[model samples]
Target: MKSVHMDVHALLDAGVIERRAAGFILPYDAVHVDFFLKAG
Candidate 1:
């Protein structure tokens, strides 16, 4: 879970996905969040 969060954070910082208040929400055409989870 921590790794997923870290990956999501990195993605957001890299402009891969848009940041959100509740959680790491992906952009309209961005890849699925599952990618991040599995990446972790």
Candidate 2:
């Protein structure tokens, strides 16, 4: 999970990519992630 967190942090830190929203979705008893991003 730490690696994933770091990757997301890197994206958030980038200037060109905007992080609009992010969340987790639970389906089939598993965790799925959703990220909304926009390009500058």
lDDT tens per residue, model 1, 1-40? 9998898788788888776788666667646555334553
Q: Candidate 2, which segments miss by more than 4 Å at Cα? A: 16-40
TM-score of each prediction:
0.48, 0.38
Candidate 2: residue 28 lDDT (0-100): 39
Whole-structure CA lDDT of model 2: 0.57
Per-residue lDDT for 1-40 in model 2, tens only?
A: 9998887677557532445447532223553568899999
| Stretches of model 1 off by over 4 angstroms after superposition | 20-25, 28-40
Tell me the lDDT of model 2 at 5.
84
Which number leads on lDDT? 1
